[model samples]
Target: MNIIISNASSDPIYTQIMNQIRQSILSGELQAGDSLPSIRQLAKDLQVSVITTKRAYEELEKEQLIDSVVGKGCFVSGANKDFIREQRMKRLEEKLLEVIQDSKELSMSQQDVIEHLTILFEEDQTS
Candidate 1:
């Protein structure tokens, strides 16, 4: 597993850590039962505090994305496909809402936004 931290981000260090790990699990880059680095090791690797890593792991555990075993460190949890799909859809919806707000602030019409989205969709398909 690889994690990158940015001092320029608005998010806290722990939140950045959590978001990266969450994305990895949701994208299947981290599979069920895959081991994660120990908290101390990850802290050393990231040059962050162990408390920050622990907080990220704890939050993931609350979301049932990972599980901790005594003396065994942490591992990704098996997920229901439906639940995972719902999670991804919700994230997309949140991003779409942000785009909609931005478009409205710029006085862009609905049709204009739709056209832009269509072009982006086609561009993605072609790529």
Candidate 2:
């Protein structure tokens, strides 16, 4: 559970925590059955309010990313990796749709945008 909170971001603290944990789980960094720190301990470690950590944990549970077992603390949920990957890709497509719309509004042709994306993709692949 390596989380670095960005206090300067517009996102709320709890949302920052939830998003990072979810990403970690989806990326296989936090595997199923991995134990998460207790809420109190995490709060102290992150130097955030207990309520903030609690809310983040609660949201993660709701998203089925983590499960709380009585007397055992919280553990990463047994979510299928394929499903998580699909879900993440779908979310990314939605965001890309918004960016595509903005690109059109800025008078950039689709081909231009795609060419730029291709360059970026190639760079990423090389790296």
Candidate 3:
């Protein structure tokens, strides 16, 4: 449970916490059944309000990324392969949307964007 909060970020503090935790789970850095710190402990460690940490945990639980156990603590939930694939696809769509917006701002044609993406993909494959 490593979390960094940035007051300067446009995202809310709770959102930042939630996103980082979600990313850790999605990336397999936090394995299934891994114990997470108690909400109070995490709040103390991050120096954020307990309410903020609670909200983040609630959201994660709602998303089925973690489960809360009475008197124990929050723990990472087992991953569902289908759900994970869907989440990854959603993330990819978000990133592509950002790229599309950037390309529009730069007056780049669709073909130009596709060419750049293709080149990047080739470079990545080669690397």
Please provide TM-scores, in order, for all candidate models, with all chains considered together. Answer: 0.69, 0.73, 0.70
Residues 1-127 of candidate 1 have per-residue lDDT tens digits of 7899999989999999999999899888999999999999999999999999999999988778899999999999987757866876897999999999999999999999999999999998997
TM-score rank, highest first? Answer: 2, 3, 1
Off by over 4 Å in 3: 88-127
RMSD of 2: 3.4
Q: What lDDT score belongs to each candidate, Candidate 1 first?
A: 0.92, 0.91, 0.93
Residue pairs in collision within model 3:
none
**For residue 82, what is the lDDT in candidate 2?**
80
Model 2: per-residue Cα lDDT at residue 126: 98
Candidate 1 worst ten-residue window by lDDT: 79-88
For model 3, residues 33-90, the per-residue Cα lDDT tens digits are: 9999999999999999999999999999988899999999999998694797697699
Clashes of 2: 0
Residues 1-127, candidate 2: write the lDDT tens digits: 7889987889999999999999888888988999999999999999999999999999989777899998889999997778767776898999999989999899999999999999999998997
Model 2 segments more than 4 A misplaced:
115-127
Score candidate 2 by TM-score against the native.
0.73
